[model samples]
Target chain A: MLHHTLKISLVAAACGLAFATTANAEEVTTERHQAEITTVAEGLNFPWGLAFLPNGDALITEKSGTLRRVGTDGVISTPISGVPEVVYKSQGGLLDVALDPNFAENEYVYLSYSEADPAGGPGNSTAVARGKLVGNNLQEVEVIFRGAPKYESGAHFGSRLVFSPEGYLFVTLGDRYSAMDDAQTLDNHHGKVVRIWPDGSVPEDNPFVGQDDALPEIWSYGHRNVQGAAIHPDTGKLWTVEHGPKGGDEINIPEAGANYGWPVATYGVDYDGSIISDKTHVEGTVQPHYYWVPSIATSNMIFYTGSEFPAWQGDLLVGALKGSQVARLDLEGDRVMHEETLFAEAISGRIRDIEQGPDGAIYVITDDRNGQFIRISNADD
Target chain B: MLHHTLKISLVAAACGLAFATTANAEEVTTERHQAEITTVAEGLNFPWGLAFLPNGDALITEKSGTLRRVGTDGVISTPISGVPEVVYKSQGGLLDVALDPNFAENEYVYLSYSEADPAGGPGNSTAVARGKLVGNNLQEVEVIFRGAPKYESGAHFGSRLVFSPEGYLFVTLGDRYSAMDDAQTLDNHHGKVVRIWPDGSVPEDNPFVGQDDALPEIWSYGHRNVQGAAIHPDTGKLWTVEHGPKGGDEINIPEAGANYGWPVATYGVDYDGSIISDKTHVEGTVQPHYYWVPSIATSNMIFYTGSEFPAWQGDLLVGALKGSQVARLDLEGDRVMHEETLFAEAISGRIRDIEQGPDGAIYVITDDRNGQFIRISNADD
Candidate 1:
């Protein structure tokens, strides 16, 4: 359990450089305290996902379908072997990485990515796979989940994954651009969140388990393109950030079986400045807990529970791929109270993923041909 | 002069019907009062703008380049002759209407619409024209203001017009979709709010009157598509609502010589889920007073000053075309304290404009092939 004052740190100014040369402390004055952005590792290609191991080592996933490890001493490893083949197309490829809660004993790691249909379908969809981590390679890999009704459009393949406190795996899915209207239906996996057991089996208590017309693994429905997700430490509920067309990006705490109106009720218009719908609120559809007008193009999010920044405990930190910044959101209970952008344009490139390392420092990876992994910490430390 | 309380009205359900058939008081429960939606007139073609005359009759602009006058008895006259020829296209055509501050003495009515370039250019732009209302004809009509550098695209032709307390005329402009980048530049009127005298002469104190290379009429710059605007009774400042791509619809208080970040500092992304700008906040740029995520597709707005809704005295009433409703925003000084959606799907089409009549009732015009003129008042009245 983490207990600390929520001192907000806003904005950063970090120039891309090698870890050894940048360790001298490049400080940025934020609202509350002075923070430092130090390069952890660089020279990676389109790093998309990151996770920390018990031994303080970090595993990173590149969008081009490669997994690599970085040692605590900042030594970068070659691509790990036996990773699943991913469809590395627009807004797809290797997406999120997560470790089983019992990873210390099981050594299990999970990866989410865009998977081409095995049955020779026209398009690809998001898939989740897990394997045991053994000496630089993932072995016994098995596909755990696959989003349904693939389309040819290369957009909106939401692939973020998180583990609920109840030990169930939750996978976020997108409404493939060509199939956005179907997001409202229950039979398909488009624009949905699913809960399953560790071995790829549907959880018996899943929201749609007993329903005939609905997919058995569905936990919630009616999402646009959810790329960021996390569990609230205090409430033990899953919170997600999704992209809305044109302007309505939203943060939602999805409840079981709830419908989050996508095309039917949205705050954004169509890209061509035409109205998609005339309702931002519908009776049965869940309203976003918080939403961004002129979306930030949110990619990933986390509720700060690490001890590194005592003031950030319980605050929500979100990564923005468009603005290349991190949004630090202060919350009072379920309501978002305030937001401060950390590292706004301080780093050049799209922010792909963010994680709090075991050392308590925040780690973020930039998505680019030559990507860099960086860590944020209190300058005083 | 209007002096009154702001009784906030939220949500409605008035079915489309003839004026007499819908006049029996169809009541809807709002947050502050039981409001009634009465059809004042129906069967107008895409009514876009509405203004009340001293005789209690209303002047309305139909998008198809027609101006009609509706009497106090709900009798709509034939299209007013001598109106400006307009380019009736997507998000264009006849837009806003306002009366001169001294309409009793001058009978000067102002109309803003999409004007085709006289030079036979490829596209059209927003233009404001003024004329005297004599019976059913607009006598001695003259074009007062025209947005510069037209594009071929038929999107984002903002044409909202309002009169200032000091009798200066203000016209809101758009960033014409193809020319969005020019919004951050000065030399053009794209994405700008301009101030001029009633005779179309530039005000000497106008923000950019003498600024080299900048448009002389530009009072403020850096906007997307401004569709809604009103003057705060207490502060006497002009507040505007502009459509943002995707999600970033904003309400801004335009100040002279100020820059409101459009393409540079927006909260939204491009329609293709790409990053527009990662920075929502930038130095030297004005932030919006309020913004909507997954925008409500705001079309027009007015600061409520009618005696009919006492509880809504200072609230801002905004019309939404995408949501087909009015947003009642409660304000405490400059900040938006709360918001309530009025007439969510209660009406059949897009709400293009809203006004406060001399009788202290709220009036709104719907935009559709078969449009309507409606009044909202306390059911007890």
Candidate 2:
């Protein structure tokens, strides 16, 4: 950003101490495990995304558009009704919240958000939707897919969705960051990712389905804002993570028509730290089965196949919002051999969505305006 | 922003508890005020702008571009040397710092940052420089004034410099938030308010000096991101505060070429709450001697005229960052009438610059990486 602020102002003036602790710690032991954390639901607002429900309750959402449900006994519930309007500024709102691998029998639910320019066009993008739920409300909603040429910068709205196991659906999108060169163009869908079919159509084997210059629901393009996504129960693939910019964050695994180079081959640098691409490997793009340099801004991701930390099953976890913690990783098949972090100092705030529940534990939520939810578990059980 | 997040998600779902305490408080009593906050100077990092030195030391800055110097006996000094390079991401770094209404016959100083885009052109604006300090180091430097058509979104930067009374220098900018229609364009300087001269020249009575399509160091036009500016020791006028979106923060006073209607007459709404203008009063623009509806996100302000809080003298204090606290206000001439807040529980963090200290005490800093310079005197001094 200005040559990383003049190299941290001449290395913090030759280290005479410019400080850097940002505390944290409610209980963390990690050698292969320890955790502890708790909260389990306490208010909630900037909560952004979290799913769950086969009756264990959960839902969440909030960046300001509300969706709430909570209750595995921690209480919460209210605000759910129809849910759609969102743009909640800064990082745009009501983002991510899944459910519907036939939620029992199609009780559906989806969500994602940021959408405003419904063609009145002044700026705003990233949409998604779908609904059904019924009881707390949301019966027949349906927006299903948006991300296009909208701008007005309320900062990037990556949106993160994820369905696939063959049910298709994916989503992701984001380079709305003043449209970073339309994240390597493709007839437009800002940073691309697309895929669709939870009723939003598209998906004919996606990846530019019938490209007339592309956009048939592109599958992957230079993505510079994909806030965490997941699948990999054993590699049904589709991984994602995104953010970067002042330290490239990435994760990726997209596939299809792939490009994945953002602001051209970035390994991060540019939130004014400038340098957007000294080439973190270009030429045909696609790298990063893991990245993150000074960024922990990553947001939602899952995969641990739940069962409460059997040394963290197949590991992955994620959710960070500027290093506020969770991370985990440790996979193997697609890389990321070891990473850890989890509740670093016990959820100080901003982890935003982690999920695992069904009783096995883990959950999380935090990006505040009162946000908390949390859970973790197995401090040696 | 989405109808204020659907009326706070239907009133926090009819108040089932979504939480909103945010804490704060090291000791406050307020009737006429009690105050007792100390921390003197703790490590530092995101601590943007402060400036004291008539020998009482102070100086600060550090939005990762360093400049230290802290002692009135609080000891911080270490990274000062010459201070320039900044654009430290997000709110862009090393911003606001002043001194030199002939800083005792030209020791100068002045700062304000975010630059980067010096014609190689890509994006980044907001500049200002000046130097000369000579002790912890600075000697000569220069830069002067930049702010023009840059565009890359690190979020609205609206720096804050102030000096006026006739010595001119003002500064205040910020429509960089995706250039909200270039804050009512006047040939671009993003959201205007210029007036220079401590060597940066252009101040032939400003207000668009010789307007050949405006830009002769402008001096006021629609705003939308001004991070606090001051100058009314007795109506020498100037005021300012800005940053509204999801409840307009404002304060204004500005005048000169006037305008001030932001995204065209706003009381704020668009942080995804949408509705940038139902017109808070259009005709010739200008209206807001005070505003703030759920946005204590203000930052940097001062008018108190110090003496260890005579009943807060001319009272005006301010410094907020998403309401982390210290509002105070009170005034009557420019009409505010009463406000209060201050540490709201005791600085839970994010206050960012608010000075007065030449021994009349008050100081404050916060915006964290670990930041904390604080002082706030008179518990009954």
Candidate 3:
């Protein structure tokens, strides 16, 4: 274990040094128990999200509104038919995918996408839907949740979905551009984490369920753009990683009815250098569990419980878009102890999503026109 | 004119609000002026640089190592032959193109590219070469200058070339990823601007011409990655715009032998959220004429002296990569008076390069796999 720790640290240090030196330096992976990286699929058009099935195949969502399945042997299926049409604009399209907790019996698959407003407005909203998977196509699909107050912007449709132990689905939403204040308000679904039943019904115990003006689906608010979310294995809590403007990308444990101060209080400034807030702290909002200063353009994340990598157990693995690496955050209770960047040199493009495979290997998806699905495993096995 | 200013301001204000709201909002251009945006050419692969010929043709350099010409009427010619083999990698490859001061007589065209190291090291360096253009082929091509101490990273090879009215060529070099410390040193060329004659010989009047142990070609030092450069119309000074890591993108008047301060004095933190420098200001280092926090990922720049945009005369127009907008900086003497972001709604993808056309219109290239060359003119005209 000590040897593995040293090797991982050296790899992290090498990434920092490598970035400081060459422009075309091939990402060099260090020996952490001789870990092996293998390609699972290639030629993906900006693959955004991923989920696994009991049969060991994986369902991947492309940002261009296609769904694909990758076999255990790395054979990628054609786009699954009956996938809903997506907005398919800048940063919008088919997003996250996950299996229903009772997938063996239900065969239900959940998806998040940028849904064009039915009212023909200038904007689209993040929406969640579920369908029974029959072979390569979806059957009997139904819309589950729709983000409110859709604006014309095609950016920041935070729509990652995670199911709690109690089978409640948590849908993450972004603050639609030009509606940042909506992140602070309960009247809209923008910039919020909403908890609901599998059939799209709001839970009676939801944080804002009794409020007259607030949306009953809102579990928490004040998020900028939560792209990655995962249920903590040990605590069963929902933890998220969000993209900050220039800096201040954050990791948070969003609780019931909590406010995660955004434009009102942030470590980041406006893109034009104007101050967003006078302080990083606000009177009534919760502080982030951890925050990044320069920002890595964080994407999807997962709490690892896999047995293949003993050292990484309980660590939070998050994908980085702009920084082009996987960041592993070691936690001591709720506070982050250390962050070690993995495969910075090995992964060439923006990391879009991360997953722990059924066989205990790690899988990551890159977001690019020529994207790839990469799997990392212990070479000793 | 007041109406135009108000329109521009409203557009700029919209951008600020848009950024505040949606992380993925498509920049919506509100018509401030009767500006007509037309496609000049399409289906280019990440066009990086552009230069106009005397014969009403334009030379374009694709980042993927191809060069082509576009007619005044927007017909794209086949890839030109006889260009040197470039080490096409991330942020490297065929970059800036410029015409010689005596192009009519010499028929000389200058090209900058990431040249693979002849020593077979896993590295490449920025090189500038000149060749005579003869019927879609370069004849008598000879490399003039090669950046020294080549390293293996492919992120920052700042290769913008601008010719001073005095007939000297200015070559911008990036702080070859790991060699940022060399930016403050006189021993190597990384992260420094060098001035040379058309034949690659160092000009005697260069700042370090007689200095001990310093590369005599050095004009300015301590630039991180200068992608945009233009000569001031009146003062004939070399003005540049360079990318900052997170925030701290800057515009500078690079004085001879002056230090601009990279890792030593930066407003940006490391991508991993670590502090890059303890200070944004230090003694003896030059401050930027203008800086953007949270970064716009600035690319190429041009100082407009065109008659078509009368109010924009003497203003600096810059291409933004991340913000996907054209930034217009209004200057009062050396200090920036105001900034207005234009064409944000019209252009999509990363703006790689900008040029002022012979007809006094503005042309820009987008840095996408499916990039396009766009022209902007007064819609009324």
Candidate 4:
């Protein structure tokens, strides 16, 4: 068990050291802020994910489990048909949507969701299925990955999907609100982030491949519900966002076989305000690079590296659900020089998802009926 | 109640409007399809709110109710010493944080949370307060606003804070759980977004200010738990995000006395998979500009107008908690042109808050003990 305290001063100094770099307090930034808000698409029913097609259009997903073809006119084509029925529920439904890393030729699309199980088992688990674009509907739909130890709750089925440049598929799983301790276990898929091949087979060279002591699909463990994962644009390092119970949401640079210490070290308390764990910090349990205390109820994140906003060509953009806003970070070296809140009063809804489109535009989906397919561009700013 | 099915096709039409303005479609971008992940600060318990000092440092808030001043070195100062104890419970704690528009003139910071009843009343309704920053400790702390008809549940205390450029402070309120019927009532503060003066007084020009039919603090009524609100940088329009049970999370632009359906007109079912109200749309209830069929557990949102990232200069960044990621939105007008997912795999946590820093950077607060204080900058993405 890790010892946890609401220490203010002690952790302050160590936090600066963890990042290995510091911001120059004396330095001045003359750059200005100029964010424009324009409507890229009007009506979208819980557009969950975005994939920028090479043709300059985009493919989007709806939580009710529909694949949409959005063209330059913002005209959404017919539901493009051919999607499996998702057991849509609280925090469950057609979730994150992704495109093949090499979509120019194959037109393959990867979708992540809580698939309906006809197997007379638990209701749903994190599932990743692959298919190619045949006309409008998805063709050759095949299950590529499945989360294990499925259970009854819809509270924590993390079904975000991503792909490595190396072509491995990374999928996230929630602990199904049952096994808080199982997040630290290796045998079950609950509360784990897994990596698999495109064909739903475990990669032989994965972090714990062929290891008796570890789960074969695990790239990382000890996560409650991981929603966001992206490969670093510069270093290609993988990073993830994990949810905490009452607080303790985390952004981690997950290493293979590392224990994240769920039901253990936590800055947050339980839902009923119970003690989060016996301790807050434990040796051998990986510490998060950063954490939120009051809990923003975070959703999606992206690194902006486009020409539309030249000065901001290399920055980070993250969406917050509870706080109902977006945060932009200013980094100098490895240290954050400053941080600010933008649009806290503008887009009033939980920002469900964010993506960078092929045309270099940034796209976001609001998880509301007024589930707007809002777009951001230089012109609007 | 609002029927979303009729709007589903309208949603399709909105997508068409979004496609016409592709912000980055013509640009030859430098960065490929990857995002950068960097942790700017650690040791923040629940860095609920992030704001920049004029000199470019940051002030962070923890859910335990302590405010920490974060330096560029990532070092956190001990608690600022002057915050009032919060009614920290299931969903009640030191909640949203914001800066006074005149922070440069008078280091005033505003906070909103469910405060324990010093007078020995129920601790459910939220309150807003302001204090001056003198060194690390807050001075002149004053209760600027208070909620009415205090209930008992810790849930639905939409306590996020925001300040309009017009000098009015906006406070989001929750239905405090199934107080769905409470949203339609004016005597209670259950489900409504309010506009208030800085001194804890009701604004005279408020939409429902003089009317005996509604609470004086009410800016708009008929809302569920409105967790997100923002002021549009261009139009200065107030946008809001509200959560519906099972599915219908919503975004609304407020009109005086407008009704946003809670128990009615949602795409979502109940937690037990039951119908909320037989209707998905109503004649008088306001409709969401966008919605998620499957809820994303919406939180805060931000619109970017920073020069640091030219590509995303004018975009919206939204955070999803249950969906566990940040979303970037490219806008053409009011519609979403594209929807993209960022940090879907990096942080396995729910996003609680998002902010843009003074140095044209992005700051994010995740809600977990491992909750994170992340900064995004030009070099990182």
After superposition on all C-alphas, the RMSD of every candidate to the true structure, in Å, is 18.2, 24.8, 19.7, 26.5
Determine the C-alpha RMSD for candidate 1 after optimal superposition of all C-alphas: 18.2
Off by over 4 Å in 3: A1-33, B1-381
Error of 2 at B373 (Å): 3.8
Candidate 3 per-residue lDDT over residues A1-381, each given as its tens digit: 112222221112221222111112122333223466666667678999999999889899999999988776556777898888899999999999999999999999999999998888777899999999999989999998888877889888997999999999999889875688889888998889899999999899998888889999999999999999999987899998888877678888999999999868876766776766746668899877777766789999988888887767887889999767888765545545345677876667899999999989889889998777878877553
Greater-DockQ candidate between 1 and 3:
1
Instruction: Tally clashing residue pairs in candidate 3.
Output: 25
Best by TM-score: 1
- Residue A344 displacement (Å), model 3: 0.5
> What's the CA error at residue B38 for candidate 1, in Å?
26
| Structural RMSD, model 3 | 19.7
List DockQ, one per candidate, in order: 0.02, 0.01, 0.01, 0.01
Candidate scoring better on lDDT of 2 and 4: 2
Alpha-carbon TM-score of each model against the true structure: 0.52, 0.29, 0.48, 0.47
TM-score between candidate 3 and the true structure:
0.48
Candidate number with greatest lDDT? 1
Cα lDDT, all candidates: 0.82, 0.76, 0.81, 0.70
Candidates ranked, most accurate by TM-score first: 1, 3, 4, 2
* Fnat of candidates, each listed: 0.00, 0.00, 0.00, 0.00
* Model 4 per-residue lDDT at A44: 69
Question: Quick one: how many clashes does candidate 1 have?
Answer: 34
User: What are the per-residue Cα lDDT tens digits for candidate 2 across A129-199?
Assistant: 88899879989898877776778888778877878788988888788776788789798888878888898
lDDT of 1 by residue, A4-77 (tens): 23333322223332322123235665543467776766778899889999998899999889998877656677
